[model samples]
Target: MDSTLPSPNPALLVPPSMPLYDSIRGSIFAPSPTVLITTILVIFLTPIFLHFIVFHSRSPISLPTFLLVGPAASGKTSLMTSFESEPGQPPVETRTSQTPHSLECFVPASIARTSEYRSAHDPSLKAHKRFLLLDTPGHGKLRHIALTRISSTTIRGVIFVLDSSLTDVRVVAEYLYDVLLTLQSSATSTTTQSKKLLVACNKSDAFTALPPSKIQKLLEDEITKMRVSRSKGILDVEDDGEGNDEKEWLGEGGEGPFTFQSMEEVGVEIEFKGGSVENGEWRNCLSPWIGSCL
Candidate 1:
C-alpha cells in the first residue's frame, strides 16, 4: 500500500451536511417572530424576575416591638384589636389573652415623627416604617408573659392601658408599679437609651372615668405608698452585699413622693394620655406617641 493510502479521498474528508441540519441552521439564523419575541421578553423580564427572587425570599423580617401591658379588664386586647382592625370598620371584639400576640402596624408618613414630612401616600412608608404591637396577658398569674417579653424582646415602647373607671384604682397602680420597676431596673443596667411609656387611660368614655391628670396623681400617690412599704421590707431582710435597698426604689432615692417625672433619672420618659377605644378615639391620639418611639 502506498505510504499514505492515496491521500484519503478529499470528498470523503468533507462533512456531508444533511438537509435536516441545514434547515435547522437556517431557522436559527433567520430570526422569526417567535424567536424575536422570546429574546426580547427574556431581555426585558430578566431583571424583574431577579428582583422578585432576591427581595421576596422566604426569611421573615424583624420589626421593632411595642408591648401592651396592664391589669385584667384594662383593655389591652381591645387596644390591640383596634390597631389590627381596618379603618372605618367596627373595632374587633377581644377576649382576655393568655399568651403574647403580635400584630404588624405601620405609621403613616403624615404623622410619623421618624419620617420626614411628606405626603401620606409615600410608598417608602409602606415598607421601611413598620412595627409590631405585642399584647400580653394581664391576669396576675399570666403577667409573667409580659415581663418575659420585656426582658427578651427588643421592646421599642410600652403602652400601659389602665381602666380609669375602676372603683379600686389601687390595683391598677400596684400593677403599674411593678411594671415601672421592671422597666426602671432594666434601664439602669442597660445602655443609655431612653424607654418610652404611654400611660393610656382607657375607658375614658365611662361616666366615672378619671382624667389622665387625675389618674397620674392617684398613681403617684399609690407608688409613693408602695415605695415606703417595699423599703421597709428591704430593711427587714438580711443585708446582703448587693445594694438591694437602692435597687428596690422606683425613682430618685429619698423621702420625697414618687412622681412620673422622677423616673427620668432612670431613662424612662412617661407620658399620660386618655382615650377610649370604644369611641374610636385613641388610635389617632397614639400616632404621635408611636412615632416618637420610632
Candidate 2:
C-alpha cells in the first residue's frame, strides 16, 4: 500500500471553514414559522394585558368628597383649576355655574374619570375621594344651605376662601365665623365624624408677596383671636347642672374656640401665587381657619 494509502479519500476531507453564504442560507431558509407566530402574538398581547392590570389595581372602592366655600371672586375657580392640573394627568375642567340658592357654584368630578384620576394620585393623600367644591354665594345666604351640604356625612373637608386685599376683612371674617359655628353645632348633634376644613387664604401674590413664614404668623394670630372671641362666648353660657361645659355650646350661635391646628396640624399647604386672570390681584384668599376641621 502507498504510505498515505492513496491519501484518505478527498471526499472525506473536512473543510477548514464554512462559507459566509452557507451560514446565511442556513439561517434564512430554515425559518421557524411556529416560533415567529408565537413571538408576534406575545408582542401584540403584552401591552393590553399590562394595561388591564394597572386599571384594575387602582380602582377605588369609594370616591372621596371635598367642599369648596368662599366669598365671590375668591379664586374658587382658579384653585380648582390648579388642582385639576396636578401631576401625571391632563387638566380637567368641570364647573356648574348655576347652583341652588345660597350655593353659587357646584363643581363635581366627572363620574367616568373618577377612578383613573384617583388612582394616579398618592393614596395616602386620599386624592381619590370625590370632591364636591361647593362655592357658596356669600355669608349672608350661607345659613340656609349650611346644614344641607355642610353637615353631610360624606363631606370630608371644607375649603374656605377669601380675598386678601379686600378693604373690609371683617365682613369676610364674620362670614367664615358663621359657617364654622354652624359646622360645630352640626358636629355635636351627629354621631358621624366631623369633616376636616382648610382655609386657602389665597392671592398672597397681591402687593408684595407675603413669605410663607409671614403668612403662617398672620394666620396664627388671627386664629388665636378667633379662639379667644369664641371662648368668651362659651364662658357667657351659664353653667348647667349637667356639668357638661361643652353642653352650653349648643347650636350655631356660640363661637367655638378657633384653632391654628388645621394650619399647624393638617395638610393645609399654602401657595403665594398670582391669579390666573389678569387685572385680578386678589382673586382668592382662603382662611387658614379651615385647617382646624382637618
Candidate 3:
C-alpha cells in the first residue's frame, strides 16, 4: 500500500502524440485499400457528376409561346408593354412596331396555376406561371414573321387584337382571315401544335365600339365573304393552269357563314373577348385565358 501504488507501471502511461510530419507521411504513403479506392473514385466521378447536373439544368425546354398578331395600330404594342410592366402603371405608348418582340410574362396564381385567389401582391405567384409573349409585327409586309413563328415555334395561343370601334371592319377581318387561314392550313401538318385563338376586340371603351358578340358576328360575315372571294381567285388560278392548294380555305367546305366554331375541325379554337387596354380592362380576362393554355 504505497501511497502512489509503486508509481504505476511505466507502460501504463499514455503514449505521446504522433508528429505532424509523420502523420502526413503515413497517411499519404500508407493509406488503406478502402481509403485509396474511395479517393480514386471521388476524384474520377466528381467532374462527371457535376457535368451531368450542369448540363441537365441548362438543357433547353420547349417554352410555350403566345403569339400576338393583328393589323397595324391595333394596340398590340401597348398591350405588350402593359402586360410586361408593373401593375397599375400606365402603358407606355409605343409606335408601330416594325419587328418582332417578345416579353416574359407570368400568370398569377389566381388563374391557371393554383385556382386559389392570390392577391395581386402575392410574390409567390410569380414562380408558378411563366410563359413567353411573342409580339409580331402587325404590318401587312411584316406578317411573314408571324407566319414563320406559327410554323416554327411551339405556339400555345394567339391573341388577335383589333379595334372594335372602327366602322369599317373589313380590314381587321381580312387580316384575321389571313391569320386564321394560315393556322388552319398548318393544323394538319405534323409539326404544328394545336392552338387556340383569342380575338381581342380592343378599344371597347369607345362609344362606337362593338360588343364582343357583335364583333364576332361581323367577323363571321366578313370571313364568309373572304372564303367566297378566295375560292373564286383559286378557281381563276386553276383556269390559268396554276392551281393553288384548296386547304387555304378558312372554314368548312360549304356556302354557310364562316363561323369561328367551324375552325375546330382544323384544331383551332376561337374565342372573343372585348376589353380596352387604354382603361386597363383586359388583364383579368386575358391573363387567365393565357394561363389555361400553358
Candidate 4:
C-alpha cells in the first residue's frame, strides 16, 4: 500500500569487473607488436581504400579533343576563355606567338558531365579521356602550320570563328573556302569520319551597326554554298570511281559540310568592361552541332 516502492537493490546495479579499461590503457601506453602492426596496417590501407572509393567508384567516358581556329580577332581566345570551368581545374590558354604551337591544359566541364552520363548509362563507355582545346594563332602565314597541327593531332572537332562585319560577302566566302581547303588537304587519316565544324560569327555587338537579317542570310547562303561544293566534289569522285583519284580529290580541296551562324543573330552575348570585351556566352547553342558530330 506504500506509495513508494522498496529501495532498489544496489548490488544488482554494479557491473562485474574485468580489467578491460586497464588493459586498454596499458595497450595505449605500451602497445604490443600486434597492436602496432594493426595500427600501421590501418594507416597504410585507409588512403588506398579512400582512393578507390573516390576514383574507381565512378566510370568515366572518353572525351574527344577539340581545336579552336579562326582569323585574328575572330574571338577564339574569348570563346576558349568562356568555356565552362570546373573548380580546382587548371586554366588553359595559348602561350607562344609563333613556332611550335602548344595548347594550354584545362578540364572542360562539358566533358566531365558527358563522362558522368556515360558512367550512368553505359559501362563500356568508361575510360579516362580528356577534351583538349587546342588554341591556334590565326595569322594568315601560320594557316598552313595550324592546319598541319590540327591534322596531326587527334582532333575530335573544330570550332571556326568568323567576323560578320565584312562589307563584301565574297571576301568572307573566300576566307571560309580557304579554311575548308586546309582542312581537306590536312593529313588526317580518317576519311569516312565526319569532323564537326562550328562557325561562330563573332562580334555580334556590331549588330546595331549592321542589319541582322542581312548578316544571317549571308552566313546561311555561304554555308549552303560550301556544303554544295563539298557534295559536288564527293559526287565527282564517285563518278570517277577510282580510289586513288577520289583520295587525291578529297585531299586536294574537299571538306565536310559545316554548320554556320552569325553570333549576333545567334544571341551570343559578349560582356565588356573598362573598354575591353569580357567573355562571351552562348547558352547551349553549340550543343546540337557538337552532339551530331560526336
- The prediction achieving the highest TM-score against the true structure is 1
State candidate 4's TM-score.
0.46
Provide TM-scores for the models.
0.75, 0.45, 0.74, 0.46
Whole-model alpha-carbon lDDT for candidate 1: 0.82
Error of 2 at 20 (Å): 89
Clashes of 2: 20
For candidate 3, the 10 contiguous residues with the lowest summed lDDT are: 108-117
Score residue 207 of candidate 4 by CA lDDT. Answer: 45
Prediction 1 TM-score vs. true: 0.75
lDDT of 3: 0.81
Clashing pairs in 1: none
210-276 per-residue lDDT for model 3 (tens digits): 8999888888888788888888888888899987777766666746778889889778888999887
lDDT of 1 by residue, 64-140 (tens): 88999999888988888787777667789888778888888877654566566755677766754678899988899
What lDDT does each candidate get? 0.82, 0.50, 0.81, 0.53
Better of 1 and 3 by lDDT: 1
* lDDT of candidate 4 at residue 190, scale 0 to 100: 47
Q: What are the clash counts of all predictions, listed in order?
A: 0, 20, 0, 0
Ranking by lDDT: 1, 3, 4, 2
Residue 161 in candidate 1 has what lDDT? 90
* Winner by lDDT: 1
Q: Any residue pairs clashing in model 3, and if so which? A: none
Tens-digit lDDT track for model 2 on 239-266? 4332335533322233444334442222
Order the candidates by TM-score, highest first.
1, 3, 4, 2
